[model samples]
Target chain A: MLSRPDFHALIKENRVHSSLYYDERVFQEELENIWYKTWVYVGHVSEVPKKNDYVTKAIGPTPILMVHDRHGNISLLQNKCPHRGNQLCAYQKGNRTSFTCPYHAWTFANSGELVGLAFPDGYEGVDKSEFSLGKVPRIAIYRGLVFGSFAKEGPSLEEHLGDAKRALDQMLDNSPEGELELTAGFLQHRTKANWKFVLENETDGYHPGSVHGSIFQVASSPVPALYKPESLALTRDYGNGHTEFDLRPQWRHVGKPMYWFNTTAEKLPLYTEAMKKAYGEQRSQEIMIDGSPHIMIFPNLFIAEIQMFVIQPVSVNETIQHVTALQFKGAPDFNRRLRQQTMGSVGPAGFLLADDTEMYERNHRGALINNPEWIVLTRGEKRETRDEDGHRIGHSTDEVTQRGIWRHYLKLMTEQA
Target chain B: MIDENEIDPSIAEPVALSPEQELMLRRIEQFLYYEARLQDLHAYDAWESLWTDDAIYWIPANGENPDPETQMSYVYDNRSRIGVRIKQLKTGKRHTQTPRSQLARIISNIEFIAQNGDEFEVRANAFIYEDSLRGETTWAARNEYRLRLVDNKLKLVRKKVVLVNNNKPIYTLSFLV
Candidate 1:
């Protein structure tokens, strides 16, 4: 293990060594400390909608089977049979009352409690009751989203989320019923990139203009080349490794802006209009257009309410992004079709996302180059910083948010739990 | 083989083709075939013009449901969304279009299901093959089309595609199916 001084010295410079990306030692340490200790998102509560419904997900290197129990509670357990360490639950998702191991006929309930063993005579003195599928150390839910932590003790889920919960609230509040549910299915993609690259890409406003230039040109006519600095909202160094980019209404004119605001300033009437009527004009406007851009909940969650992109990281470098084209559950069919058309473009295979993924792959490959010692995130370095709700603001094109992520990453990697 | 007139209604219906109805059906078939050909040939601009200003395109998420509002969908595009996509495809900076996607489509079972004045509904079956950096992916589906005659020209009002494997994991769907 590297000494504390050496680790602190490397992190203090705010630049990470390239070896960290490919090193097995660093990967193992992150699994032990970061992945296991932090409250990691373990799929959404809406995924396993019914009793016995289950989906397989990975937390770091560990494969976890997430299931909905009889009482509608979510449980995360090791996807391994204790009897012979055989891999259980081969299917990605299904409704099963019990999982019977193929090797020895060991049965486990949907709750992951071992209920049966094939041979009782073989273990004459050994107790079968002592053996059960290993459960995650901590499981918690916040506003219907489920999360799990392998650590025995740490900050509560709410405490760990900190101000990030506000983003979650805004997402759920957008729904007419004041609750957001996962769409029927998800779009899964396997990309060659570090997991952090995925998180950084989601909130990195600076890249949309350059990296996705082809998409912008193809999607927009007489492409608007002017970059209005005032229209972009940049905030860096949010507590607990969080960063947010709030694009101004003007910035929405980039390619095809969301229906929330159009060229005529006509806002798409939302499902929560009653709340708007009750709150009056000022509060209603704030709630309606308070923040339209993407918000990154540090570590792994990227919530893009405008385009309907919800990304969940599966590994240190691999991510499983679930893109849902959301529509008001009770809305009219016409309105729903309209919403789907606008929202569907953000999926993994859509035109916009195709370009975005290409850039992500390029970045991943570029980072692996032998020459460069640091990936410069020094855009808009001289911009003034303004504070708002524990966030520091910079130009929309600034790399301040990326720096914020790096700072938090250093803190997590260097901190002693 | 049984005679055409002796066929059962449940198994098959009388193949009727009226002059005007035949013309309309032919136009609809050409519209769908041309649209598919454009996408297959990577002619995005030509493919985009098949829709009217208010045309709606949908690929329903649930295999059994015809409604797209309550259930999710894979691809839904309108005028603005389609315009944005066209722009993205034409943009020189798109890296995913590096090698560009090569596609071929097979369309069959063209028939006019319903008609009312200048408005008509047509249905067909399609099989699309797409090859790109990710690899080649095949999609087979049935399609329902609603068209309206505006200014003496056929324009799409709605196009609903029902994929046989609608519930399966979709590979990259970078272009129109």
Candidate 2:
């Protein structure tokens, strides 16, 4: 087994070793340290809005069932029956008042309550209270986004989020009702690469100019040429592996309302009026001008401007990314456009993400070789500055975001060991 | 067969098409074959040439509902967006299709589901194979095509491809598939 000092050597001050990407022993260590010992984004409440709604999910290979019970409380229960360790919920998602194991028919309430056993005579002196579904210990929600941590002790969700909370607040405030919905179905993008590549690419301000050059040339996207080194945009690394591509700095130049959607406030009079009434004209105008955030919360969640991505690490060399368009509760007129924009940008067949997937897969292949022993993370370190909030800020095309991710990864991986 | 005399009135027998109608059917099948050939060869420009001005291309998501306005789909493009797709593919920098995948597909079980004057609805089973740097991937789908005859040419109005792997996660589908 690799020791704490070995981890420090592998993940250096500014460069990470190639073995970190494909080493089986390192992968197992990550599952123990990074995946199990951190706060991971589970899902959203809007995904299971009604009582009796349940969705099966996983946290580092541990099966979890998030269900809205009879009392409308969402509980994170293990999808396994306490008896014989059989998996209780089989379906990905559904509506159910209670769950019954298909193997032995042991029934339990959707709220992690052990209502009854199949046949009481099968075992004597078996305490029904001892057999309730196992709870995931730590569950928290901030602005309707649900998160669960496998570790019982650590930073609370609010503390772990820190300044990164601004990203979620920006998205929620983008809605006139100060609420966001994620009812839109996912566009799953399964790629052959390390899961960290997804998070690294999420806040990557450098690759857009080169990796997605073709789409920029063909279409008039808001991101066209906005990712260059001289662009006014800033790549920020908030602590805890949380990072952001804060385009608001550059967008301040235009200051046009709803420019992110390539539409004017005049085109969306309904949304304009709703926003004006909701937060008054001045703040609404600012919200419209600033637009949505493109940021990544460490471990799994990425709020990609208009869409949300959940990165699932299947193995050392495989990953599954699920993306869904963000839907506002009261913004009915504008939700359709968000869906269209999401389909156009991020899915498997997306004009931009398809090329990105190619780059990531190519990185995975190159990481397997022994030629280059290290992956450099020293692009803009010399000139990088700090914001008032202590965020490490770099020019648009810099390695500040990636360095931040690695720094946080090293901390989590080594501290636990 | 003694049709009218021996058959019961409740039974509806299939009628033979006129020679002119048969010829039109043959032409329609040939047009479908030509379209598929263009896609396999990665002749994006020519493949796009088969579409009319008001083309609608949609690939619905996991559910039975194929509505683009409500449910999320893999690809939903109007005529203008379709033009954008073709433009991106031809930009010579799209790495997903950098060298272009060697594609071959087979289409069978063709049937005309509906027809209204010059417009017709056609459905067929499709099996497509693509090979690239990532190796081979086979895709199976039911192709739903809406075609219209304009100036004696069969032009595509809409297309909906429901893939067998629609519900599960798959790799990059950058090509015509």
Candidate 3:
């Protein structure tokens, strides 16, 4: 166990030791105090569309089964069969009215209720009512996304979201029907780095120009009129460790040095015309020509205003990110296709994203050597902080957002449970 | 020029052709082969040029339809979008592309589906293997090609790829499959 003094010192300094990434002790602490205690995003409500549909996932090593009951309420339950401690659901996802454990034929309702048990003669002396499936203490939903917390007491989901709710609203507001549906599949990728490293990259704005320079060069070379930088806005310090970077108009232009997406007038017309047909001229123009922001909900969820990326920490040094593209509940098919194309650039197998994964691996490899002291989070220090919708804004290249995340991280890590 | 009426009917029914039809098909095939070769060689720019000024590249997410307007696709690209992807691939700072995506494509099973005046539709199959820093990834799909012939030259109207496993979880699709 780490001494309280050591923890306080680390927090007061506003930085964490490199060991936090690889130390089993710190990993365990994070599992208990952070992941299990906070409302961690499990999956979108669209994942379990039908009654009795269930999917399995891991929240900091704890296997959980998310099921939609007959009444359509989604519940998170421990994947264990209360009888003899056997795992109940074996598959990744499937539709079944009831789950019968292969070990003992102990049957459970889709709602996690113990419905049947075999060999009544062997259990005559025991009470079957006491062996109900253990439910995740708290399960909540914010804008169609489901989250589960093991701790029975803590902040409410909205309270925990704090100022980050705006980012969530950004995603929900984009849908014409005021609802977003998680597209059919996901892009899953595993990385050899501390999960925090992967999670932090989602909101880090400083790396784009430098790290993706080649991409910018190619995108800008033939179509210099496409790429622009001024239109991008990087916002840091939404309370509770959340940060967001809005890269829209400026980043959409074709030939400027920056991230992916060609922001050319020629290309805009194609999307604009399609959008106008689907959503009417004004609304279609707004949805297509104007780019969306990427939101990083502190600790784990990376909601890209239009898409969703969930980062799951597998081990002290392993992480898995699940990328899901979302469609407006009733948007035109062409718009969905356009969204999918943009999403593909960021998906696990995307040109831009695959490069990011390699960078993470390289960073992890570099961090493992000879005890590197610190990974720099100091960029755009001279820029003034502007307030926008309850967020602190900086230049597109600013690292202040990353600093904000580390600050909240230190606070969470130092607090006593 | 080879007469459309003289062509074999077993492969596909013969349709009326202007004097430029045979030349157009040859040019279109050349463009298709060249694009496939570029992707196989990881030359994104050369591959991107097979499209017309207003063309679309699609990989359907589900269903048998090749339309990009109404269905979700693995990849949906216009010229600008494809340009951005090429830039991303060429960027040295791209962590995922550090080792670069090495690819090989086996394209076959070509057949003409439809044609009207300058616009035509062709179908084919593609098996692509892409390797990067992570590992090797494989994709196989039936493709639908919509081309417009102008002045005896072929330009892409749409290239729709239907992956055998479009609904399954995919790692990433950085390059054209």
Report the number of the highest-lDDT candidate.
2
List the pairs of residues colliding in candidate 1: A195-A316, A195-A317, A214-B93, A214-B94, A218-B87, A218-B88, A218-B91, A219-B87, A219-B88, A341-B76
Arrange candidates, best DockQ first.
2, 1, 3
Residues A150-241 of candidate 3: C-alpha lDDT, one tens digit per residue: 88988898998987786676566455565777645555666777887877787776666666566656544321222224544555678687
lDDT of 1: 0.66
Q: Comparing only chain A of model 2 with the true chain A, what is the TM-score?
A: 0.97
lDDT tens digits, residue span B1-177, model 3: 111112333545656655676666666677778768877777766666666878887766634453455434556777777667666666555566556678888888766666787888888899988876556778888888988876666777888887776644455565556
lDDT of 2 by residue, B1-177 (tens): 111112332533444556765676677788888888998987889989899999998887764344578767999999888889999989989999998988998988776666678988777789999998888999999888899999999999998888867867789999986
Q: Going through the candidates in order, what fraction of the true interface contacts does each contain?
A: 0.42, 0.71, 0.40
Q: Which stretch of 10 consecutive residues in model 3 chain A shows the poorest summed lDDT?
A: A219-228
Residue-level lDDT of model 1, residues B62-175, one tens digit each, is 353534654456666667777776776776555677668788999999878778788888878999887776567788998888999999888888888887766544545666
Q: Give, for candidate 1 chain A, the lowest lDDT window spanning 10 residues.
A: A257-266
State the lDDT of candidate 1 residue by residue for A1-417, as single tens digits: 553334454443335555555445565666776787888877777777888788877676577888897556788989999977999877667777788888889998888778887777886877666788889989999977778899889889999888768777766655445555665455454455566677777766666667666655554422123233545455555667677765443344443323333321134444335445555555544554543435777666666644444444444455555565443333343235435544455554565666677666666677678787566666765774867664766776677777777677777777787
The lowest-lDDT stretch of 10 consecutive residues in candidate 2 chain A is A1-10
| RMSD (Å) of each candidate, 1 decimal | 7.2, 5.7, 8.8
Q: Rank the candidate models, highest TM-score first.
A: 2, 1, 3
iRMSD for every model? 9.5, 10.7, 11.1
Compute DockQ for each candidate against the true complex: 0.22, 0.37, 0.18
Displacement of the residue B2 alpha carbon in candidate 3, Å: 50
In model 2, where do residues sit more than 4 Å from their true spots?
A1-5, A61-63, B1-24
